[model samples]
Target: MEFRLSEDQRLLVETARKVGERFGSAYWRDLDARKAYPAEAWQAICDAGLCAIALPEEHGGSGLGMLEMALAVEALCAGGAGSTLAQLFMLNPIFGGVSIARFGTPAQKRALLPGLARGEVTFCMALTEPDAGTNSLEVRSFARAEGDGWRLNGRKVWITAVPQATKMLVVARTRRVEEVQRRTHGITLFLVEPDRPGVTHSAIEKLGTNTLPSSSVFLDEVRVEPEDVVGRVDEGWPALLEVLNTERIVTTAGLVGTVELAIRLAVDYARGRRVFGATPIAAYQGLQFPLAQAHALGEAARLLNRKAAALCDLGEPYGSPANQAKLLAAQAAAQATERAMQTMGGMGYAKEFDVERLWRDARLFRFAPVSEEMVLNYIAVHDLGMPRGY
Candidate 1:
């Protein structure tokens, strides 16, 4: 199998790296401290067309595959803008626009794709609720049939970008819980506009990744038309999986980049900072061994991420690969960031150094996209011939 990036992919990676360099740790730190969105950095990424990396050429995108998208996100995170712009841009094509492209009507595509390509409109995936974190089949949100339309009533928590999103892909139950044979059935997905009278959002206070605002959204009898249905009514579980799987793979790429950056920073600091002797801390075998281990694990995770992305680009079966990639990469990132922080000693705890921020941001990966435990369960049941745990 091929192990290297193509010439065009390499060029895209370089472009993302250059664009990301404009917004360094300082900028991200300021935004994080102020709990404000990184509008400038986001606009820069959009102006570079990074947000359109996965859209088709017909949709005003570069027509790149998920591999190219992963490379671009990796480059962005490697340049230290990991916390602010990676998720927004990297997932734009797959999570934001792909549903529309794959399942949207011609009119929907014509109406939404161009603005999304230009970053004029933002989309949020609304699936997770307070009661249903990992068990998405237990969703309590309901979309009842109205006069040739639907009225949705539900509450979604920890929804990213909901406050600023013009539109959202909301997963709700169109049929009652007892009406379906499988809990996964009878669910539906809709693209809901939050400006309607029945929708309201409150921003959540998060410990990290503060650049993007998340909210608890309440939908109270929000009216939607038949045109708003994505894919099919009571068949949205599969459509939502498409987006969530893409999210896992792409987010893993960003985490891989963050781990690489943390390793580099730690190595740089360890090689320069003198301790008990005339030489630097790099002379310490205790520190050197862990640093090497971190580098090796990060590299391994990176390779897995690329493999998953390649499978996605080829339209192959990617569910298992994507979960594996996310699990490995997130673990690697968390370990690498933690080691880097420990290697930096007291300075790592300080926000001025930025390793601490990387540590905090790296942590969200284990819990997001899919939790580490969920990945393990998926592997056990699907790959190991074991019975399903959940």
Candidate 2:
């Protein structure tokens, strides 16, 4: 795999970095404290056309690929805007736009995607239920066929960007579990207008990522029209899986960037702060080694993420590579953030230094989108050809 970015990709990264740099740590800290969406930052990204890089040209985007998307997100996080900026910018395109571009009818694409490209609309994933967090195959949200439409009834939890989203790509069961020959079958995808009647949501108070809201969505017999279906009925599992690699790859890139930023902050603090006869702590091997090790791990994770994203852009099979990248990047971010905390000591714990905020955001990746244990399980079963354990 090539280590260097293409000229265009480099330009894209530079543009994203500039956008991110416009928002200072004080801006993010205030928003995180208020648990409010970074509306101004999000609008800046949209206005710069970064949000639509992956969309097709006809829909007013650059018609780029996953590699370009990942590059932009990485730059955004590395510029100190962190993962909320990345998620708010990319979630609609990677999760919803890709699915629509690939599977939607021409009418569906025309009706929804242009608004997405213009950032007039935001899309959130409404997949996880109270009982179906990691194991989405067991999702109990049911959509029953109605007269030329459908009626959805269920609850979804841990849905990101709910407050800011205008639409949702909702996954539901069309057939009962016992009726399907396999667990993956009988699932369906629907494009839902979230503000319509019978649809209600509340923001979840979480440990981190306060700049964006996670929500619990209640779909109480919400009506969906026939044109809103993303793919063929009872075939949503494969459709959802089609975009999982995109989601994982972009997220891995952001995590890598965040970890790199943590390492940079730690190293800078260690070098400048003097202790014990005016000696820089960075001179001590004890403080230096862990940060160095974290840097190595973060670089390795970045390489893996690059490879996975490149494969995605090439239209090659990238599930294993993307999953592995997510696993490594999450671990690397956790370690790097923790090391940054230890190096900065009390200052790191304080909000002004920004390491504490970065630390909280970094830890979210270890579980959300996909857990580390699940990635290992996938590697064990698919890569190693072992019997499924769970």
Candidate 3:
């Protein structure tokens, strides 16, 4: 199998790198310090049309697939933007935009996709409730038919970028879980405006990745029109699964990028640091092996990520590979950042080096979108014919 990136993919990597460089470490560090958003970097991304790479040409995007989008996001991470860039660009444009582009009606597409492509609008997924977490079937949010539309009431927690999002795709139970033969059924997707009469949100303080705010969104009798439903009613499980896989792949790509950055920082410090007066720390294999091992793991994670994204683009079953990639990539990012900290000694812990920020952000991947445990459960049950665990 060919491993080389095509010319277009290479260009995408280069362009993304340039965008990341244009923002630089100082830009990201300042945002992290104040728990502020990456507004400038996002505006730059929008001006460059990076938000629409995965969108169809008819929808005013570059007509690229997920693999290409993953490549760009990886570059963004590698160039020092880290997880913030993904929250600003990928979370909405790739994950939320793809759902609408693929399933929305003609009118829906005409009204939404163009604005999303132009970066004038952004969408956030409101799937995770305080109680649901990974157990989507446990979502207590419910919606009922009202006149020509639906009325929704629910609470969503840990929603990324909700404050900046113009719209949200909320998953709610249209029928009681006990009434449905399968728990995954009875769930429906709704595209709702966050500024409506009954919709309100409060910013949630998270441990890391503060460049994009997390929020708790309250939907109290919010109304959604009939056309806002994505895919078939009570058939949102499959559609949500697709969106999850896409999110995992892109999130893995971001982790891989962060790993690359960590390795670079560690190696650079090792080469320049002099402890014995006459020799550099790079002379010691003790410092070298861990960084080398982290590099190897990052390389492997990148390959798995590419494979998963390729499967997604080909319309093939990619659930197993996508989960594997995300699990491994998250592990690699955590290991690489930890190793970088070890290699740099105390400097890695300092905010100036920026390894601390990456370390914190990398830890989130181990538990979010889908946890490592949940990924393992899925692999065992779906791929290995094992009995369900949870």
How far does residue 165 in candidate 2 sit from its true spot (Å)? Answer: 0.8
Model 1 CA deviation exceeding 4 Å by range: none
TM-score of each: 0.97, 0.97, 0.97
Clashing pairs for predicted structure model 2, backbone only: none
Each model's lDDT comes to 0.83, 0.85, 0.85
lDDT tens per residue, model 2, 1-390: 467777888899899888877876678889999988887887788888888888889978889888888888888888886665667744688767888988888998888888887778788889888999989899999988889888999999988888778878899999979898999999989888779888999988889999888889999989999888888999888888977768897788888888878888888899999978789998989888888888788788888878887887788888998899889888888988898999999999999998899889988889978899999999999999999979
Query: Tens-digit lDDT track for model 3 on 1-390?
Result: 779999988988899899988887778888899988777787777677778888878878888888888898898888887755776655677556878888777787888888887778888889999888999889999998899778899999998888788888898998888888899899888888778889999998778998888889999999888888998888888888888888888888889888898888888888899988979898799988887888888888889889998988899988888889888888888889998998899998999998899999888889988999999999899989999966
Worst 10 residues of 1 by lDDT: 83-92
Please give the distance, in angstroms, between residue 371's alpha carbon in candidate 1 and its true position after superposition: 1.1
Clashes of each: 0, 0, 0
| Superposed Cα deviation of residue 355, candidate 1 (Å) | 1.0
